[model samples]
Target chain A: MIRFDRASKRYPNGREALSGATFEIREGEMVFLTGRSGAGKSTVLKLIALLERPTRGLVMVNGCNTAALASRRIPAFRRQLGVVFQDHRLLTERSIFDNVALPLHAAHAPLKDIDKRVRAALDQVGLLDRAQALPLELSVGEQQRVGIARAVVVKPKLLIADEPTGNLDPALSMEVMGLFRRFNEVGVTVVIATHDIDLVKASGLREIIVADGKVQDPATEKLVVPSMEAER
Target chain B: MSGWLLRHVQSALFAAGRLARAPVSTAFTVLVIAIALTLPTALALGIHSVRSSTGEFANAVDVSVYFKRDVPIEKARQLAASLRQRSGIARVEFIAADEALKQFREQSGFGAALDVLEGNPLPHALDVRPKTDAADPAHMESLRRYIAAWPEVELVQIDSDWVKRLNAILDLLRRLVLGASALLGVGVLAVVGNTIRLEIYSRRAEIEVTKLVGGSNAFVRRPFLYTGLLYGVAGALLAALLAWTALQLLDAPVARLAQSYGSSFRLLAPGWRELGILLGVGALLGVLGAWLAAARHLARIEPRS
Candidate 1:
């Protein structure tokens, strides 16, 4: 679950990535953050991930205020959620199994449990046979699947992905989207940020459109600015 | 607890594997640390050997009490007996004027000149040796004053100045060794710290990925710490070996030099205690250097995307 009440983010370089962006997504919902490049979708996901706190206003994910969360608690907070990046972010020197086992290792899980779960996650991504292969040795889609397996290996309640299919063919992109859909079907809340409007339309998921540092209502095609006076 | 230990073992093995993969660089780093550590270790051992060998000479300080020419040999013997009775005096030997003259005649080659001059011109004397514990400068000075106050005593010479100078030199050398050890210890830390920093820089991608997947700073730093620890331990062990080998090579020469001086002093090998200290220090420096590098660099590498 996520709630952003007029959250604003201004980076150190003075670029206002997000300005007064307000949105809400309930538990067990799969939502697409549709926006152009540099349109602040990634900034929203960053706030949710606690990678950067909001410059102003409040951003809450899973009942924890991203702005108020202590820096020491950020790791534990992140462990409860999954994040997938467009680049896959796999350690190239490690095998696919080791890459997927990163999250479990971070958690200090039992070695037996880690082995079992890593295998299961790799199997889910249809890459069980490539467990011993390095990331560079795999195809781009297989690498992305390894990233996905790493994300879900810990069984996080919430999953957020940024441009998950940015480098994939349309067919590979559809397959990746289907993998996310399968996870959502099992009640995992998913938030994906992408400029793939076609995929959003085809997936028939709820879409929150962001442009020019503001979130716009897809229904009305107008900016959905929060009423500040009502909150006061 | 077992799981925690397993993680540590895993990190240690992983760190060792990384080092093994880069044999040339690791060996070079270890050599630098070993050389730095070896200087202080060898110096310390040298000081220990020197101190132990010179211990008897330092304690052999003797006071010579010469009696007046008119003093009778019986009276001088009685005085020597009384001096020996004192608690601080270990032994006292009374030499009659006749015996002193005979020894001087035989060794100084002045028997014909002395016989032409007078009969038994040398005075009676007592050689007084003090207990080792009471042989300090202050104690010896007091004993000299006490002996000089006697009515029949003409002179009381301590013969301890050379001993004082030798002790002072040894003390200075010990302090120098301590200072050198400290400075070189810092050098070791710097070498290890820089090495770890480079390793961290090269593994920047791995670090970012680990942190991106919810790894804590401690988790990300574990491997680097292990690497530093290995470097330190390996360097220390090699330093000990180097110091031992150096001692072995110098042993024959040193013994020959001592023999030339009519002494049989041999160089003492580094004892177990010294080896333990070297190893412990090496391990501590390694861990500390790694910790410093990780603390400075790991926190700055946040996942950007």
Candidate 2:
């Protein structure tokens, strides 16, 4: 569903965040993006989201080279995928229902359909009862669920979640991962970038490790495994 | 969304709702604008009324017919009556040679000295006033020439000089009104522009969010434009009302002043054309201010870093 071919992003003041990184993500498959801090994990997701343009090489999502998509068309490209961030990025001023309904609004969905889908998505995340509550009134985990509900409300074909479990306790992290797994089971392709090795291992999903502005095949990395507290 | 667009028109009717939201502030701003716009408009209207009334007073006096010295009082009186019956003549008064002399004695401070004279020195005359249209220069000249050729008439002196000068004064007053409105119009634009600039600064966060959500520049500008248009309509309406009231307030005083000067003049407000100019200037000031602010600032913010 997505491909990054020798993509490199260089900031103006000589910050090379990504360099000659080559990778491919197939359709309807869930992949774990494992990397240390500053391994260019967020850059990869942003590239797919078309929030930032790559300095060189082609990045394709859903059969179109996003590097060539006009700025105005970026919203349409983003609508094709659901995005869950570590920060949730939910608008605190609005109710949970409104936050989740944003993606549909961006797509200019019919009111009836937007309402129906928003309820259904919130129900799937078990936040239907709190739909009218503002994000600031909700717990951090619930806020993350609101973000998840927003991402999936449009039923996008691809889901790119950056550090989805970064700010959560292990229990809540597992629960959120379970939600992503459920979405994946319904033929939605999922890519999660995380620093939590234990959580990634617990999911038993294929891991693609990134380090020092480069992506590597996990099978080829022979470095000692970084130990993690499984229970923590 | 089309559905949101329809339903949210109720939501976007923010001009009224926003005013309702902040009544005191809204009223304060509106009053400031109205006062700013009203003073000059009222002055223009007063000057216009004075010019029109003074012009009419000059035009109303009409022609003076100096009869032949040998003509009798009865002949002059008959001539006055006939002129009063003329198609365009409004009023005519006959002055007998003796009556003229007697009035001259009273006004010239020679009442006692005039009795010392053996014969009346003043000639018999007829004062004729024409209708408004007949007071035109060409028409007055025609009437003067026609009356001057009469055998019983010794001289015919038509006074249209005051009419010419009144017209010149009126033209100047009109130019001054236009100049004042123009200067104040620039002031209005600056006021709206500054207000919009403050609005843009205050709503910067909301704007960034809108852009991040894929809103176009036009979408970002819609609310501010609406706000400016609101200020314009509101300010113009208040200015018009204030001008009308000022005219009403001055009508009695102005009429009394004219009466003291032996005139029947009254204060007059602007006609339809001036009203159009007033509203047009308001709307124009609003749009220009909004456009200038939008062009200056909104274009600088990128959607995302």
Candidate 2 local lDDT, residue A137: 95
i-RMSD per candidate, Å: 0.8, 3.2
The segments of candidate 2 whose C-alpha lies over 4 angstroms from its true place after superposition are A34-36, A75-81, A102-107, A206-208, A217-232, B1-8, B14-28, B44-61, B64-123, B126-160, B244-251, B263-288
* Reference-based TM-score of each model: 0.90, 0.78
lDDT of each: 0.90, 0.79
Model 2 residue B196 lDDT score: 81
lDDT of 2 by residue, B1-305 (tens): 56867534633485466556777876776777778789788988777777766764665756889988888888778777877777877778788898888778776888898888888767899888888878877788888887888889998887767777877877887888788777887878888888888778866765654554445566667667777777877888899999998888888998898888668888787778878877777777777888889878887765442
Clashes within 3 Å, all models in order = 0, 0
Residue pairs with backbone overlap in model 1 = none
TM-score for chain B of all predictions: 0.86, 0.75
